[model samples]
Target chain A: MVFNYPNGKKYIPAAKIEAAPKIKKQKNAAYSNRGMTLEEDLNDSNSFYLDRNIAVIHKKPTPVQIVNVDYPRRSAAVIKEAYFKQASTTDYNGVYKGKYIDFEAKETKFSTSFPLKNFHEHQIVHMKAVLEQGGICFVILRFSTEEEIYLLEASYLLSFWERMISGGRKSITKEEVIECGHKIPLGFHPRIDYIKVIDYLYKLS
Target chain B: MVFNYPNGKKYIPAAKIEAAPKIKKQKNAAYSNRGMTLEEDLNDSNSFYLDRNIAVIHKKPTPVQIVNVDYPRRSAAVIKEAYFKQASTTDYNGVYKGKYIDFEAKETKFSTSFPLKNFHEHQIVHMKAVLEQGGICFVILRFSTEEEIYLLEASYLLSFWERMISGGRKSITKEEVIECGHKIPLGFHPRIDYIKVIDYLYKLS
Candidate 1:
């Protein structure tokens, strides 16, 4: 008996691309001048960790609400109409050393403090859920101008967030973050290398 | 100073769908008669688990490579050209009771046996990685014709897959699955409560 898949490959409902257009590799002098964003650094670090068979963390794909699709002849299906959907959880999550690791990375251009406004209420609630489940949840805050990175635990952020909602400071002071969070020195190969900090924070637990 | 996001929200890159067209909730007689597909059942179960705060499992969004995006209005950005990219990991993964749970779900109409071809090599490799990290990894097989669902451990599937590649049976017999795999009974509320099986299997270990 032959079973036909009318909607070929139900697992991957997205359009398949054939003969991917070659990307022109033109180098720009200013390309290296632009520092890597927190996302890029974390992606590079995740790849590095993955390649070495160290962990299985991945950045969840951006959610898209597809409405209309066009299947061009002999080529990939083109998404003619789609909209982005809000993420219900943090950006990055995966398993490391038999423990679940989850985190969100955010960059702040502010010189003195990180604004709590940058994070959404839903994200804080999601982090709370992760913490309740015994998963390691944290936020990687990148002080872009200062080129400093810190890993702040979800518990620390939760208290401050609750305080803010209760008519407290709207932002987390730089001094408070420095006191509460762990500093992660930047590395060349893994870029952000947040796993080292994970090791420090969650290895015992 | 107030900083306004010209793109209302930068965190969620997807476009917001305002005044979404009515879904026209017409019930198709055939759709209801045809038992819920594996994907739908799992989605329902995940929602059930999430609503009760019992677990936080989610199906990863399909990955798409966006080529052209059109900002037709100030409020929404429309994806004009995008292609789906192949996934590197299993479909469903999340933390449950402090343990990392990862699994793939597939369905076959064959009543006698479950074919191994439904799974990809990369997915098997991914399950291996998850296992190595001490995470729970498995496959949920749905025999559509028989209306039976079985939860087979990654180790069991790996053994059968290796046997097939080494000049053995290309499929796992229904009897074998029944003997080696745990049967997951269908439910009304949670649909496919595979967590119940997980609790029975891994709660102690």
Candidate 2:
């Protein structure tokens, strides 16, 4: 279950399975014929960019809250108790083509719409802040069932976020996304060629 | 004892004391009447800038390698085993005045020179990556005994770093830093006025 705070930060307080099992599930899914999940593809693409000196982007490490730790004589410090912490910002951020790029990636099984609940109020607030700072900010939407992906500008998402708060539709229609967002064609070397789309939109040469 | 990896990342493998004690030491150091240490003062300054909407900079959370975690019914997932992981990049990064700002802050007790040991090889590489991308990258050097702070650009530090590897002096003399870096005057609210120096260097209005 998701426990959301007033500021729109949701905390998943309990785990149905252990950490290793959870990771194993992801690994199995990653090996599926679909190449890899959008997240893994993005990570691999970022690594590819880094190795080639094309760009420097990294997924921020998962935030964890430590409660207890044990210091063994000659081994690594063992964390005895900790909890996952809600992140205050988006997942990906770095420099590309002399500009700061910030984005979030989300995948939905639904065919017709991207659920608004996938994003949080705080994330929208963060995107706005990045925009105000003149940073390039956006969200990558992946329709897993259809194997399609689109990059939507933060400004467009912000309007929809505000509208949802004011009693509008709970999700953005697939048609709306297709109209406003750039379609990122998947490829081999850099599986998700989102940078090409960024250059097109921002005119960064 | 600090465990130094060949790549220059230091791992505090064993905690001499509990996590609370570790934080307490930092807190006590932060409460000095003369002025907070460079790290504390910078944290305060960042908070000031954040509250005033002047900038959005943040220290990355310490990286941890989680080995085991426990799930209690209706409660948070507790990490049972983990180790502190070495960070690949600098401590602080964020948006400032429509530019990407990335930096690491370090203080030296030595009065004569800033030792090269304070910085890691990987950090130098990370700084260089940021620089190549046209990001504003630098290191804030605090001569603690002298109660002076200087903003040294990554390029300047990179030169010294390369010199050290080529059998030069193991440190950068105070005179050299003074010659190449900008002095940041301490203030009340924000404490360290480093952004003023950035504005001067970058000619950002």
Candidate 3:
């Protein structure tokens, strides 16, 4: 999936531009072996939540800018020309126990640190806006190499983002993530049981 | 703009498929006269609210399923083939004062009643889920002919939808809407000024 800014510049994520590890090959192999990506697992878990009346969360649709569309008389309209517009917000959001929940999910090959560049400038702005409105916002980071998943609050991520902007660390170390974030145990029925961590973190029940 | 179901059926809006007045030309004229659509006005209002540190609301991007892409040498990747997918949920959603806000906006030429078919089945189901989760869910109906706008709670909408499904009135009478819904006064800085109505209806100070 190629995403472009409104100005038509191709967005090359920093994680993808790295040279050391063969992430692409591993990504393909992971798909074959695991049979799902973090996004797919999250989507599945969200549906499980919905079915059980636990929460109402969904992945926002990928943003696309349609340029030219063709209406073939007897068939559905077809988009002939379009560009992938960059998203201005996080990927998933919904109402959880009467509280607004917003978050983004990302997986990295690194075992020690999660790079900050995996997120865009607009997404941070969006997270700040959500936090200001008193909504619960966070990021779910998966260290593929270590097979560990952690949920880090957006406030901590925002501080790190500020540090990065001021010429500090470009990545959040695993130790820092461990200190500030909560680990979510993977499960079968709901796949990644993130709501449990949320419940515990917020003392919702 | 043409939208389609994931099953490939073209979605002709209930308002557009109706006969009598040429809604397309008037829709185009509306864009020319007001210098915006309802979506545009709400977007402007949301930005105004954002700049003033009031609330955070946004219209989700149009959903599209990409079928083919062209990554020509040095140029940005272009979507060569795609199809618009029917949205599985309402359009605008966000957080306001620690509460989840979810709603859809529709402008109709009808002056007497608002057609039930203006909404899709999936949207109604999604609205039910939000309501069950204790989220603020409502519909903003713009009666273009009367130059009036009303915010009808999702519960009223669900009842009317049930009536429609059980061979009752296919639309909600304007009188019923006036009795059950809150009238939102049009504004300058915030455009539609719907949040004020939200504040009043929800009794949030």
**Highest TM-score model number:** 3
The positional error of residue B71 in candidate 2, measured at the CA in angstroms, is 1.9
Top-scoring candidate (lDDT) = 3
Ranked by DockQ, top first: 3, 1, 2
Stretches of candidate 2 off by over 4 Å are: A1-35, B1-37
Candidate no. 1 TM-score: 0.83
Task: Give the C-alpha lDDT of model 3.
Answer: 0.81
lDDT per residue for candidate 3 within B34-131, as digits (tens), equals 65667777888988988888998988887776666676753366767666677888999999999999999987788899998899988999999999
Candidate 1 vs candidate 2, DockQ winner: 1
lDDT of 1 by residue, A60-135 (tens): 8777766566666534566676666667788898998878888998877787999998798878988988888788
Candidate order, TM-score descending: 3, 2, 1
* Candidate 1 clashes between residue pairs 3 or more apart in a chain or in different chains: A84-B14, A84-B15
What residue pairs are clashing in model 2?
Answer: A79-B82, A82-B79
Tens-place lDDT per residue, model 2, B87-127, is 77898888876788889998877888999888987789889
Q: What TM-score applies to chain A of candidate 2? A: 0.85
Off by over 4 Å in 1: A1-32, A73-75, B1-35
**C-alpha lDDT (0 to 100) for residue B53 of candidate 2:** 76
lDDT of 3 by residue, A108-189 (tens): 8888999999998889999999999999999999987666889999999999999999999999999999999999888898
